[model samples]
Target: MQRKKLSHQVRVSTEDSELFRQSVTGARPLMQDKIAPVSKPGKKKARQAVNLSQNEQQLFFFSDGYEGFVSNSASLSYVQPGDDPHLAGRLKRAEFQPQVVLDLHGLTQQQAKTELAGLLAYCQQQQFNCACVIHGKGLGILARKVPNWLIQHPNVRAFHTAPKSWGKHGALLLLLKINQPELALR
Candidate 1:
């Protein structure tokens, strides 16, 4: 490597050097010490098997029973019977922005299910109106399974294939049920 020299060298005059030394005549020397960064360990929650909801548990209960056949490229969508028919349309149009997103790109089916449960549960817990689930991968297995599994979640009001801006065919936009519990009568 070639070193570039300064265009002009700076030289301090003897009078200027004497004035600098006089300015800090009584300064104390600083102690040389190095501090090792200490990071506190976070509280670890108990590691236990994730308990699936009754509807979710049924996924494992049925042996080739039926989840309704869905073609790989078909648009996955649904709105609960009593819900506003337009709710699904809103999702289709990407009107409501997803507040939280869960991506299942690299997860296995079982792992995806557990993570999906957590995402939905969190949405309900936080009373989120919309959430997105991205399941993009080489195969469309997750794309088909996620929507079918969502159809059974009670807290889900409606769901539709996400808009192009939201992952298009590789994702789903969810309209979750907002729960507001009454603390007491004022």
Candidate 2:
């Protein structure tokens, strides 16, 4: 028997080969272009974690250490003469009544340091007996740094973590200069 050669048409069908070539050319750019990067969530709590409720009071400190509060206070009407940079001024309106507590969870380390000092001076000058400091239970933001500094401050009669209902590990109840609890009344 004689050997026979395969027909050219048998090697590759024209229409199929053209289709394969078109697909390969069309997909080349997709392979060459860099893929879009995917974003990863931070280990820290989500934005919802820090958002406040309807009745929740706002407390924020500026880069210069000026504090702002969202509640009303009777003491806000008693204004001191001369401009004071550290004083909250209108920002001090947050409710500071004996039972009502304010949170300080959002301050940065440096802001908290200044806030601690300003608070001590406020107690020494105006005579507040008790105050709350909300220092959010982050990585040693307040547990180590704030307490260490508070230990040496003059007006800090006592300071401890707040009750669970108020802020738990996220806040502190500061007993200001005890002798002047009456000043808070003035």
Candidate 3:
């Protein structure tokens, strides 16, 4: 035997959507918090590369928002770059290692901006000197946008592609720009 199907008519209106649009239109624009910009016009920006003389103590390796050892406090002194090598080698072989590795692969551009802003803030607050951003190889997803945005942020001291051991070209090593207290210590 075949069963008869019963259906009821449903009514819908755009009232909720219309109200949301109205509210959005009435909302004021968010004011951005201002800060001093790094690498200002005509000012040369400094790169963070540990030289041979800087290898007085072994810098620790930390990642994924966790704290870790600074390796051997004594070996820290030996983590310096010998000479004209690439930036990745310098950072990877530095006495101190980066403390964070932010995975940006799944983030949309808006998400990247928001997360990166938070990461920069965190790096500053925690006195973290270095960070890694895994943006992945440009398969056309984020591509140029992510790297360019990182360079433009004021709190970013330095950023470049990571070495093979440090995540290869899919990641970026980020240096936290030192502020008054941190700068005074250096």
Best by TM-score: 1
Q: Which numbered prediction scores highest in lDDT against the true structure?
A: 1
With a 3 Å backbone cut-off (N, CA, C), the pairs that clash in candidate 2 are 71-93, 71-94, 104-134
lDDT, each prediction: 0.80, 0.49, 0.56
What TM-score, over all chains together, does every model reach? 0.64, 0.40, 0.47
Ten-residue region with minimum lDDT total, candidate 2: 54-63
**What tens digits encode model 3's per-residue C-alpha lDDT throughout 60-131?**
121223322232321111122332334434665543467987788878876665566666666766778798
For each candidate, C-alpha RMSD in Å?
A: 8.6, 16.6, 20.6
**Clash number by candidate, in order:** 0, 3, 10
Candidate 1 lDDT over 1-186, as tens digits, reads: 999999999999999999999999999999879798899999989844444573364344222334863645567778987989999888898889999998899998887877787777677668898999999946878877887778777778888889999898889999988888878978
Q: Sort by lDDT, best first: what order?
A: 1, 3, 2
76-146 per-residue lDDT for model 2 (tens digits): 11112333333333223322333324454677776566555555555545556667767776775455555
User: Better model by lDDT, 1 or 3?
Assistant: 1
Q: Pick the winner on TM-score between candidates 1 and 3.
A: 1
Off by over 4 Å in 3: 1-89, 92-96, 182-186
